[model samples]
Target: MAIRTTLDKDLDRLKDLLIEMVNLSKTAVEKSVQSLAHQNIEMAEQNIEEDQKINDIEEKINNLIIQLIAQQQPVASDLRTIIAGLKISNDIERIGDLAVNIAKSVIHIGAGPLIKPIVDIPRMADMALDMLNNVIKAYIEKDIELAITTAKADDEVDALYGKIIKELLELVPSKPDSFNQISQLSFVARNLERIADHTTNMSEHIIFMVKGKNVDLNA
Candidate 1:
């Protein structure tokens, strides 16, 4: 009985840490994109600084998962949760890194006005952010549908990214003077798409945790 109680406390701590990781990543992605859209160099700098905090959370989650496995020796269902939680946390950490990448792009683009009025790139960021939020909810509620929804949302982000890239490629030919900003926007779009992919990976991990079967959410 004491062993079961101790395992429960450890798992509870794990869940709390996972939630902290989610919030940190989610806000990092949001603020980073906002910095890009508004040309907020100072906010971009802050976003870059905040990413270290998210990395710290990821380290804590990894350590806690290892501790739980060693002490609890969880079996089957419990074991799946611990292992799958590790995968999801890693994906979240990657998302935070992507956010940092976006901030870096803003730093690259400098303080000049965007080459074009922002449109699809912001749309893509919003969709990816939604995926992050929904995936977290699905994991916490053990809701398979919500997880699936998060995976499917990746398609929208991909489509927006494709559209942005195509348009930018065409623009570079005609707007030679603006080529630099257009190229930087392409980089930003690519980062957003990769963020969506990592968020989709999280949903796939959540499904594995609940169903005990691997899912190809990326396909």
Candidate 2:
């Protein structure tokens, strides 16, 4: 009984850390896009600098998971939970990197006046962040249905990314002078698309953790 109690406390700590990790990744993504749209260099720089915090949280979660496995020798559902925690942390860390990539593209845009109005990029970012939020919620709540639904919803972000790319391609011929801005905006959109993909990956991991079934939502 005492051992079970200690394990429960450790598992609870893992849950809290997972929440913190995903939330920071979401912040990185949001701040990255906002900086690009509003030309806030400070925010862009902060986005890059703060990504380390996400990494730290991921590390902390991983260490906890390892300790739990070694000490508790978790079986069945507990094993699944620890495995899913590892995968989720990895995906969230990648999402943080995507945020940094977006910030770098923003810095490349250099606070210059946008060649075109900012639209789809920010929209896509919001959608991706929402997906991330939903997956984390579903994971913590043990809601496999919500996890599956959120993973499937990545299609909207995918569609928006495609539309943005097509529009940017069109802009090149019509506005030859603004090619740099168009190209940079395309990079931002691409980063958001990848972030959405990572969120979907997290959702799949969550579903598997609960149901012990392997399914791909991206397919």
Candidate 3:
């Protein structure tokens, strides 16, 4: 009974850290896109610097999971919970890295005015952020249905990314002077698309935690 109590406390800590990691990643992504849209170099640099915080949280979650497994010797559902948490933390960390990528692209584009007004990239960022938020909520609530729904939203983000690429390609021939901005914007869109992909991976982890079965929500 004492061991079970201690394990429960550790698991709770893990959940708290995971949620913190998610929030930080979300903030990084939001700021990344905002910086790109407004050519805010300071905001972009801030998100890039703060990415370390997300990495720190991921490390803490990993350490806690290792402790739980080694000390508690959890089995069945408890073991599944630990494993899922481990996988989800990895996904969240990658999400943070992708957000940093977008921020870096913003910096590369510099503070110069974009040749075209930003639109679809921010829209894609919004969808990805929403999917990320809902995925974490689904994990907290242990709602597999919500997880599935969140994963499905990735499709819309992908569609938007595709459209952005098409539009950018169309402008390439006519807008020779805008080459650098166009290139960086493409990179930003790709990073946002990848963020949605990582969020979908987290949704899969949540479903595994709840069902003890490998289900592909991304499909």
Candidate 4:
């Protein structure tokens, strides 16, 4: 009983750390879009610098998972949770890295007026953020349905990505002078689309953790 209690406490701590990681990554995504939209170089630079916090949290989670396995030798279900934690943390960290990528694009574009008004790119960011928010909730609740729903959200992001690319390509003929900014804007959209993909990966991990079955949610 004492051993079980200790393992439970450790699992709770792992969950808390995962939540912290999610929140930080989510903020990074939000700020990346905001900086691009408003041309806020300070926010973009700060978002790039703070990505380390998300990376640090993932490292902490990795250490804890290793300690739990070594010291406790958890049961199959607990082991599943721990393994899922490791994978999910990686996905979240990737999401943060993609956010940093978007921020970098913002920096590259500088304070110049965007070649076109920012519209679909922010919409893509919003959808990606929504997916991230829901997937974490699905993980906490162990709700497979929610996971499925969250994974489906990625399709909308992909569609928006396609639209943005098509529209940007169309602009290249007339807006020849603004090629650099146009390319950076497309890169930003691609980063947000990748963020949605990572969130879908997180949902897959959550389903595996709960069901002990490997299913592809990305399909």
Candidate 5:
């Protein structure tokens, strides 16, 4: 059957907008991490400034969503799709903000001495990025199994986060002077972990979009 309703088209547009937002967010995150790892202050500043672009995209998506709701009078899955778009856009915007937070942390740390090797934190970041990328793919392709697999990948991120925390704790006790710096690194890990959680949330939203079923990740 052909998609005959204006509502369907609007919903499709909403999904497209979300996919753009996800791509922008992914670029922002990758750049933010690269800036931090390389101690490129200029690149960090650029990432921080680019957050406004993400905000603008989010605002546009929101306006489109409101327009669809007021004009389309959609039912069933169309309604669910609109709701999912709103939720997913929110998640993506927060992901952008988290990237900005990491960038800011990089500036705060400055050209300081090495706080370990940053291996674990970057590894956690890679996993989080992979989760975000795959979840967005699942949304675009309507692949439920891929979404579930992305959700399952969150476990690895959580475990890496725990390990980072443990290692930081040990470092702090031994190197009392570096406690504050280590704590900041821990915050970076926490931000990345939260990003993974948001990606998982996106996966749940994808499940809702495809199956009309709500999934509780916490349960």
Candidate 6:
């Protein structure tokens, strides 16, 4: 059945706003990494400031969601869409905070030399970003297959994170003097892993929005 209520249109607009928020968060994350990799303090600072934009968008989306619930009293799929928007917006905002945490770590580490070239962390970041991008697409299109594929992609990121942890452990033993630097790198890796996990959560929400069945991607 075709949706016949103004609530449906408002829900659609909310989804568009969410997509914009996700894109903004993605850009913030990308810039955060670039700043860390290049030791560009100014760029890192810019990322911190840009994070406010994501927060503002999230607040606006939340208010709209509340209004929909109070005014439209939508049922079934319309209700699911609003709930999904709420969940996804929270996840995206958390990702933005994680990016800011990474930037803060860069500031803490300062212009000191990296203990090693940041190959694995960057690879992990790219994977996480791709997963996030796909999640947004799947949500927008209500594509169940895309959501499943995005959930599956999380395993690749997990594997990369495992490798990073192992390599860092080895480096810790050999480069005892570089412990502090290596520790910071390890934190960055952990943050990237967390971001990927959030992306997975968003994918699961997409599945719920489309199928109405709860499936754990972590399983």
Q: Which prediction has the highest lDDT against the true structure?
A: 4
**TM-score (all chains, Cα) for each model:** 0.96, 0.97, 0.98, 0.98, 0.95, 0.95
Candidate 1 similarity to native, TM-score: 0.96
- Backbone collision count in every prediction? 0, 0, 0, 0, 0, 0
Task: Give model 6's TM-score versus the native structure.
Answer: 0.95
Off by over 4 Å in 3: none
**TM-score, candidate number 5:** 0.95
- Model 4 ranges with Cα > 4 A deviation: none
For residues 1-219, could you state the per-residue lDDT of candidate 6 as single tens digits? 343567768987898899899999899889888888899988988899899999999999999999989978888888888898899999999999999988888887789788888787878899999999888889988998998899889899999999998898899878898887777777888888889999989988888888787789889
Considering summed lDDT, which 10 consecutive residues are worst modelled in model 3?
111-120
Q: List the residue pairs that clash in candidate 6.
A: none
Tens-digit lDDT track of model 5 for 73-180: 677888888888899999999999999998888888787787788788888888999999899889889899999999899999999999989989988778998877
For residue 123, give model 4's deviation from the true position in Å: 1.0
| lDDT (CA) per prediction | 0.87, 0.89, 0.90, 0.93, 0.87, 0.88
> Could you tell me the lDDT of residue 198 within candidate 2?
90
Provide the RMSD of all predictions against the true structure, rounded to 1 decimal.
1.1, 1.0, 0.9, 0.7, 1.8, 1.8
TM for candidate 3 is 0.98
Indicate whether candidate 2 or candidate 5 has the larger lDDT.
2
User: How well does model 3 score by local distance difference test?
Assistant: 0.90
Question: Can you rank all candidates by TM-score, best first?
Answer: 4, 3, 2, 1, 6, 5
**TM-score of model 2 vs. true structure:** 0.97
Pairs of residues clashing in candidate 4: none
